[model samples]
Target: MHRRASPGSQDHFDLFPYIAILMSLLGALLTATLGMASLSLGPGVAETWDMAARDGTASKAPVLVEWDGSALTVHEGAQRRRVPWLDDQAAAAGGMRPRSAAMQRLLAEFGQRSATGYVLFAVRPSGFATLPRLTDDFRAAHIDIGYEPVGQERGVQLLSAGEHP
Candidate 1:
């Protein structure tokens, strides 16, 4: 026979098991959240890189320069100076000589570093059509250079030797 409770009596139930299950679920979610947070991707995760020499000689730090369709902006650490675009007259010269004074001086400066360093051009989309011409001009002027395509408005930061990021 089963005993029945009186109408005035109260029945209490334990909630500890349910509470424990919820707590464990919360712990698992928190752990997953933290695990996902630690995994980073893209440019943000690209912090440091050790540059290797191309020719088995001592690797020279690259000179960072931005190329839009109009001009080349050289990045020397925190400093930046724009190298004016080739003028119509220089273009007409068939790469023999630059008519612009600024272009002449910049070329002269880069000419001396051909063997010691290389120019890394961050070419913008607008500069794509003129990239070959720009590279040709630099080559004609005896400047060693390589290029990488980048977004139009993106800014590039160059890391120095023995530096990170």
Candidate 2:
């Protein structure tokens, strides 16, 4: 009988095929992971809202305001002003709370632009508790408004018709 090679004597374990298979699998996995990653990044980082009316009709641009639970930050073009809220006892004393000077200014501005613009509220979750009161105040002042809730940690980007990124 032909002498067989002694076990573990001069027998080279060829790892090339196994290494090639592993590399191929790794490459495929990496490609799949990258493809999935790209699909997950929808739009930009911030949430965007169209500046147009909800009905998708041509309408006036609104004055943007951010409402957290306790205060309002009115945005007029590039300028911003914070309007403070009344204390709980003061706000709950009567059926309606009194408006601050800043709040009145916003109302007056919206009032004047009622035909061309409306107040757009970017409300945070915290603001939901007192949102009814805020809306009531706007109604009392006869200011037209549209509101949309925003995520607490997300920034908002308002895109106008001619301006979209």
Candidate 3:
């Protein structure tokens, strides 16, 4: 003779399997919730860049300028100096003429070496019309030309690279 499970015992036996399945589902839900929470608060791209630069692998350079910011500071680097002539002043000094042969030779040497990136020019508003032709000549010789127009009030007008007219 064999003994069978009582009704109460059978109910308990069936409940154990359902309880195990519920516990597994709850664990999965908890894991997904924690993952999403962690993802919502993380560092961004700029922070990473700051950290990398601070660690000392890369360096940055300062921007170029004609004059140093402080009045006391004098810039002594290589630069182009302009000589302008007004109508009466130019007439008094005599009409415009070609650059001296020695100066032309020096310019040719400078152009060949490519030591300078640009030749800064200062011209009057009335001389603006001649700039396009000057730019063309520089372009043909593989030299970049830049200019700043000085106004009556001594304002600066920057001419962009490759800009004409």
Error of 1 at 110 (Å): 0.5
Using all chains and alpha carbons, the TM-scores for the candidates as numbered come to: 0.61, 0.64, 0.31
Worst 10 residues of 1 by lDDT: 41-50
The lDDT of model 2 is 0.79
Please name the candidate that would achieve the greatest TM-score relative to the true structure: 2
* lDDT of the candidates, in the order given: 0.77, 0.79, 0.43
| Model 2 Cα shift for residue 66 (angstroms) | 1.1
Judged by lDDT, which candidate is best?
A: 2
Give the per-residue Cα lDDT of candidate 3 at 52: 23
Residue 59 shift from truth in candidate 1, angstroms: 3.7
Q: Ranking under TM-score, best-scoring first?
A: 2, 1, 3
List pairs with backbone clashes in candidate 3. Answer: none
RMSD of 2: 6.9
Q: Note the residue pairs that clash in candidate 1.
A: none
Residue-pair clashes per candidate: 0, 0, 0
Clashing pairs in 2: none
lDDT of 1 by residue, 85-134 (tens): 76667578677544367767877888888778888888899999988988
Question: Candidate 3, which ten residues in sequence have the lowest lDDT sum?
Answer: 67-76
